[model samples]
Target chain A: MLTVEKVSKEIDGKKIVNHVSFQIKQGECVGIIGPNGAGKSTIVSLISGLEKPTGGEISLSNRPISSWGVKKLAQQMAVLTQDGLNPYPISVFDAVLMGRYPHLSFFQREGKKDYDKVEEVLETVGLTDLKDQMLDTLSGGERQRVAIAKAMVQEPSLLILDEPTTFLDIGYQLNILSIVKDWQRKDDLTILMVLHDLNLAAQFCDRLILMDEGEIVKIGSSEEILQEDLLSKVYHTKPEIVRHPKWDIPQILLHYE
Target chain B: MSKKLFQRDRMLWLWIPIFLIILLIVMSVSVSLGAASVDWKTVWKIVFSKIPYVGDWVTADWSDSAETIIWDIRFPRVVLGAIVGAALALAGAIYQGVLRNPLADPYILGVSSGASFGAALVIVFGWQLFGVGRFTLPAVAFIFGFTTLMIVYLLARVQNKVRLETIILAGVVVQAFIGACLSLILALSNEQLQTIIFWMMGSLSLTDWSYTAVVFPIVIVGAILSLFFIKDINMLGLGEEVAHHSGVSVQRTRFLLLILASVITGAAVSVSGAIGFVGLVVPHIIRLLFGSNYRMILPLSIIGGAIFLVGADAVARTILAPRELPLGIITAFLGAPFFGYLLRRAKREYF
Candidate 1:
C-alpha cells in the first residue's frame, strides 16, 4: 500500500536519511527499530509527509506523496509523534473531535455523525469516562491515549506512530501497543511505527526494518533480524537473544560487561 | 452523539444573548452619562429621532442640544469605543492562538508602535491632507501599521520558513527601533509633545461619526472573516506539527490569520490610538469564564470587549468629572488585577 524508493533526506549538508528504501503491504504492521541517531524518526517523518526527501520519491497508492493535497493525504493517513500534542485547556472530546477537521468543509460545523465518530473512538481508547475532562488534567498515558483516539477518529487507512510509547510506563506501554495491535487486526490498518524498545518492537511488529547510521541494515521477520551478532555490531553493545517465555517470539536481553 | 458534545451550542445560547443584553445596557447608560448627563429616556428618544423612518414616528420632546449631544457626540464615541475594543480583543485572541502563547496581544507585531510613530510624525509636522484634513492622520497610521506587519513577516522568515518565536522577536526589534525614533521626536518637538503623548495614552473623545464610519465596517468584516478560521486557530494551538498532521495548512493559516488580525488592529488603532489591556486581557477573561475553544472565545470576545471598553470609557469620562482620564489607564488599572485574580484562582492551565 505504501512505497519508499531510495528516499534520502539531508539537513545542512548532512545526510540524515541516506537512500532508505522499503515498502509495506496492505494490513501490515512494520516497525523501524534502531539505536539513537539511526534516522528512524526521519524516515517516519518523510513517509508521513511531514518532511520531503531530497533525493528520491515516497508514494502512497502509486501517487507521489507531494502530489496529494494535505487534507486528502490526511484522510488516508494519520501521524502521531512522541508527546506531540500539548496540554491545551481543551476537553478530551473536543480535542479528539478536531481529528474530523479534514473531512469537513471550511464553513461546516461538526455535525451529529462527526460527534458520534469522536465518541466511538473515545470509547475504543477507553477514555469515555474522561471525555469531559480537560487535557491538561489528564496524565501522560491518558493524554497519549487521547492522541491515539484522535488519530483513530480521523479514519485514516495508514497510521504512523513515532515512538508513541516513549514516555509511558510499562503497563501503559503495553496498553498503548495492544490498542494499536487490536486496531490493526480489526480494521486491516497499515501501521508504520518507530519503536525504541526492541522487545516490544519484536512483540508488536510483524516485520522489523533495522536501521543503523542513516541506512537500513536489514529488513526481515523478528527471527531473522534479532540475532546477537547483528545487533551487537549495529548498536555497539553486547546483546543476547532469547525467546519470550509466554509467546514464541525472538527477544533481546542486554549484557553488562 | 453524547449530550456533552452539544454543551457548546447550549452555552452559546445562554451566554451570547446575555452578553448582547449587557452590551446594549452599557451602550445606553454610557450615552446617557458624561458632563451634560442626559437621562436614559432622552437618550433613546434622541436616538430614535435620528433613525430615518423611525424619526417621523417619534416626537421631538428633547432639546436640540440634547439631540446633538446624544446623537452626534456621545453615541458615535461610545460606538467607536465598542468597535475599537472588539477589534483589539479579536485581534489579540487571534495572535494568542496563532502564536500558541497566552501573553500575545494585538500589538505584539509592532502595529501599535508603527501606527503611533505615524501619528506622532503627523502631529509634529502639523501635516494635513488638502481636502481631507482629518483623514490624513488615520490613513497614515493605518498604512504604517500594515507596513510594519509585512516587515515583521519578512524578517521572521528564514529560507522560506517562518518560525513563531522569530516573528515575535522581529516584532519586538522593529517596535524598539521605532520607539527610539518616537522618543527622539517627543524630546525635540516641545509644543506637539502633549498631543503626541495624549494620543499614545488613547482616548475616545476626539472621535465623531466619520471616524466611527471608517473603523466600524473594517472591524465588523474582520470579525466575520475570523469566524471561518476559528477551527484552524484551535488546531494551531495544539502545535504546528499537530495542526499539519490534522490537515491544517499551518503556514498559510497563520499568515492569513496574522494579516486579518493586523488589518482589524490597524483600522482600530488609526481611529483610537493604541488602547491597551482590552486586547490583552479580554480574551483571557472569556477563556476564564468559558473554555478555550475559539468558536466560543471569538464571538464572546467581540461582545465582551465591547462591554468592557464602553464601561471603562464611561468611567474614564465620569470618574474625574470634567477632566477625563485616558481610556488606556482605566483598562489597564481594572484589567490587570482582575486577570491576576483569575490566574491565581484558575485550577487548570489557562493557556
Candidate 2:
C-alpha cells in the first residue's frame, strides 16, 4: 500500500537518513526497530510528510508524496508524534476532535458525525470518562491514550505512530497495541510504527525493519530479523532470542556482555 | 466532553450574550462617571438617541455641552478605548496560540518598546511628523512600531525558517536595546519630560474621533482576517510536526499570524501608549472562563477586553476624581490582583 524508495535526509552536513527503502503491503503492521540515532523516527516522519526527504521519493498507491495535498495526505494517513502536545487549556474531547480538522473546511464546525466518531474512539481508547477533563491535567499515560484516540478518530488508511508506548505502562502498552492491531485487522489498515521494545514489536508486527546508523540493516519477519548475531551487531550488545512460550513469537533477551 | 453548557455550541449561546450585556452595562455606567458627572439619565438618553428607530422618542431637555460631552469627547474616548482593548486582547490571544506559550502577550515582542522609542523621539526633540498636528506623535509611533517588528522578524529568521525560540530571543534583544535607548533619551532631555514619561506609562487621555478614525479600520480588518486563519492557529498550538501532519502550512501560517497580530498590537500601542495588562490578562481570563479554542477565545477576548478596559479607563478617569491615574496603572493594579485570584482558583499550571 505504501512504498518508500531510496529516501535520504541530511541535516547540517550530517546524514540523518541515508538511502533507506521499504514497502509495506495493505493490512500490514510494520515495526521499525533500532537503537538510538538509527533514523527510524526520521524515516517515519518522511513517510508521514511531516518532513521532506532531501533525496528520493515516497509514494502512496501510485502518486508521488509531493503531488498529494496536505489535507488529502492527512485524510489518508494519521500520525502520533513522540513529542508531547502543548499544554494548552484544550479539553480532552476537544483535543480528540482535532482529528477531524483535516476533514472539515476552514469555517466548517465539527458536526454530529464528527462528535460521534470522537465519542466512539474515546470509548475504544477508554477515555470516555475523562473526555471533559482538561488535557494538561491528564497523567502522561492518559495523555498517550488521548493521543492514540485522536489518531484512531481520523480513520485514516495508514497510521504512523512514533514511540506510541513511551509513556504507557505495561498493561496499557499491551492494551493499546491490541486495540490498534484489532483495528488494523478490521480495516485492512497499514501501520508503520517505531518501537523500542523488540519483544512487543516481535509479537505485534507482521514484519520488522531493523535500522543502524541511519541505514537499514535488515527487513523481514521476526524469525529473520531477531537473530542473536544480527541483533548484537546492530544494538552493539550481546543478546539472546527466545520465543513466547504460548504464541511462538520470537522475543529478545539481553546478555551481560 | 463532559455535559457542560460551556462547551462548543452552548458556549457561543451562553457566554457571548452575557458578555455583550455586561459590556453594555459597563459602558453605560462608565461614561456617566467621568469628571463632568453626567447622570445615568443623560447618558442613557444620549446613547439611545443615536440608535435607529429610537431617535425622537425621548424628551429634549438636554443641553448642548451634554451632547458635546457624549458625542465629541466621551463617546470617542469610549469607542477608542474599546478598539485598543480589543486589538490588544486579540493580539495577545493570537500570539499565545501561534507561539504556543501561555505567558506571551502582544508586547512580549518589541511593539511596546518601539512605540515608546518613537514617542520619546517626538517628545525629546520636539519634532512632529510633517512639522505639527494632533496625529504627529501617533503616526511616528505607528511607523516605528511596525518597523521594529520587521527587524525582529528578520533577526529571528534562519535559512528562511523562523523558530519560536529565535523569535522570542530576538524580541527580548530588540526590546532591551530599545528600552535602553528610551531611558537614555529620557535622561538626556529635560523639557517635555513629564509628557514623555506619562506617555511611556500609557494612557487613554486626549483621545478623540481622530484617533478612532486611525485605529478603527486596522483593528477591525485585522481581527476579521484572523478568523480565516483560525484553523491554522488552532493546529499551531499542537507541536509543529503535529500541525504539519494535520496539513497546516506551519511556516506560512505562523508568519501571517505573527504579522497580523503584531499589526493589531502596534496599532493599539500607537494610540493608547502601551496599556500593559489588558492584552496579557484578557485572553488568560477568557481561557479560564471559556476554553482555549481560538475560535471562541478570539471573539470573546475582543468583547471581554473591551469591557475590561472601558471600565478600567473609566476608573482611571474617576478613581482619584480631579487627579486621574494613567490607564496602565489602573489595569496593573486591578489585573494583577485579579490574576492572582484566578491563579489561586485554577487547578492547572496554564502559565
Candidate 3:
C-alpha cells in the first residue's frame, strides 16, 4: 500500500534519514523499531509529507505522494504524531470531530453523518463516557485514546502512529496495541508504526523493520529478524532473546548498565 | 436529577439576560457621562429628539445646545471608540490563532510600529507623498503600514513556508529599527515638536465624521475578511503541519490573515495613534468567557472589545472634565492591573 524508494533526509549538514527504502503490502501492520535518533520518526514524517525528503520518492498505493493534493492525501492516510496534546480545553468529541476537517469544504456545516462517525470512533476507543470531558482534564491514557479516536474518525485506509503509547502505563500501552491489532484484523487497514519496544512489535506486527543511525539494518518477519545478535548489534547493547513459552513469540531480556 | 437539569436550564437562560443588561447599562452610562456633565434626563431628552417622530415631544425649542453636544460630540466619539476597539480586539484574536501562540497580539507582528513610522514620516516631512488630497497623513500611514508588513512577510518566508518564530523575531527587529528612525526625525524637528508628541501619545481628539468615514469602512472590511477564516484559524491553533494535513493552505491562509490584521491595525492606529492594551486584553477576556472556538470568539471579541474601548474612552474624557486625558494612558492604567490579575489566575489554574 505504501512504498519508499531511496528516501534520504539531511538537516543542517548532517544526514538524519539515509537511503531508506521499504514497502508495506495491503492490510499489513508494519512496525519500525530503533533506539532514539535512529530516523524512525523521520521516516514517518517523510512518508506523511510533513517534511520533504532530501532525496527520494514516496508513493501511496501507486501514485507519488507529491501528486496527491493535501486534502486528498489526508483522506487516504492519517497521521498521529507524538505531540498531539492541544493546549485548549477542547472536549473529546470536538477534538475527534477535527479529523473530519479534510472531508469538509469551506463554510460547510457538519451533518449527522459526521456526528455518527465521530460517535462510532469514540465508542471504538472506549471514550464515549468521556466525550464531554475537557481534554486538559483527562489523564494521559485517556488523552491518548482521544488522539486515537481523532485519527480513527479520519477513516483513512492507512494509519501512521509515531510512538503513540510512549506516555501511557503498561496496561494502557497493551490496551492501545491490542486495539490497533483488532482494528487491523477487522478493517484490513494498512498501519505503519514506530515502536521502541521490540517484544511488543514482534508479537503484534506482521513485519518488522530495524533501523540504526539513519539506516535500515534489517527488515523481515518476527521469527526471521528478532535474533539476539541482531538486537545487540542494532541497539549497541547486549540482550537475551528468548521464546515465549506459550505463543512461541520472540521476547528480549535487556542487560542493565 | 430532574431538579439539577432544571437548574442548569435556568442558569443558561439567566446568563443571556444578565449579560445583555450589563451591556445596555454600560452603553447608556458611557454615552451620558462624558466630559460635560449632562443630567440623565437631559441625555434621554437629547437621545429621544433624534428619533423620527418623537422629536417634537423631546425638543422644547428648535436650537438645543445639549442635544447637539450629546449627539455631535460625545456620541460619535463613543461610536468611534467602539468600532476601533472591536477591530483591534478581533485582529488580536485572529493573530493569536494564526500564530498558535496565546501571547501574540495584533501589534506583535510590527504592524503597529510600521504604522507609527508611516505616520511619523508624513508628520516630519510635511509632505503628501500619496497625493490623496486632504486625507493625506492617514493614507500615508496606511500605505506604509501595509507595505512594511508585506516586506516583513517576504523576509520571513522560506521555501513558501513562513516560520512563526522568524516572523516574530523579524517584527521585533523591524520595530526597533523603525522606532529609532522615528526618534531621529522627532529630534531633528524644531517646529512641530508638541504636535508630534501629542500624536504619538495617542488621543481621540480627531473624532470627526470624516475620520469615522475613513476608519469604519476599512475596519468593517477587515472584520468581514477575518470572519470567513474562522475555521481555518481554529485549525491553525493546533499547529501548522497538522493544519496543512487537515486541508488548510497554511501559508496562504496565514498571509491573508496577517495582511487583513495589519490593515485593521493601521487604520485604527492612524485614527487613535496607538491605543495600547485593548487588543491584548479584550481577546483574552473573550477567550476566557467563551471557549477557544473561533466562530463564537471572533464575533464576541469584536463586540466586547468595542464595549470595553468605548467605556474606557468615556472614562478618559469624563474624569478630567474640561481637560481631556489621552486614551492611551487610561488604557495602560486599566489594562496593566487587569493583565496582572489574569496572569496570576492563569498560573494558579494551569500550574
Clashing pairs in 2: none
- Residue B113 in candidate 2, Cα distance off native in Å: 1.4
lDDT of 2: 0.85
lDDT of 2 by residue, A129-158 (tens): 998887777777778777778877778999
Model 2 chain B weakest lDDT span, ten residues long: B1-10
Docking class of 2: medium
Best-to-worst lDDT order: 1, 2, 3
Better of 1 and 3 by lDDT: 1
TM-score of 3: 0.90
Off by over 4 Å in 3: B1-24, B35-64, B129-131, B347-351
Clashes of 1: 0
Winner by TM-score between candidate 3 and candidate 2: 2
lDDT of 3 by residue, A1-257 (tens): 89999999999989999999999999999999988999999998888888889998999989999889778898988887666656455557777888888888766756789989999988987899987776667788887777778777777899898988887789988988888777778888999999988888888899999999999999999987788788878778888889989889988887788
Candidate 2 C-alpha error for residue B121, in Å: 2.7
Which ranges of candidate 2 are over 4 A from the true structure?
A255-257, B1-9, B124-133
> What does DockQ come to for candidate 3?
0.35
Q: For every model shown, what is its TM-score relative to the native structure? A: 0.97, 0.94, 0.90
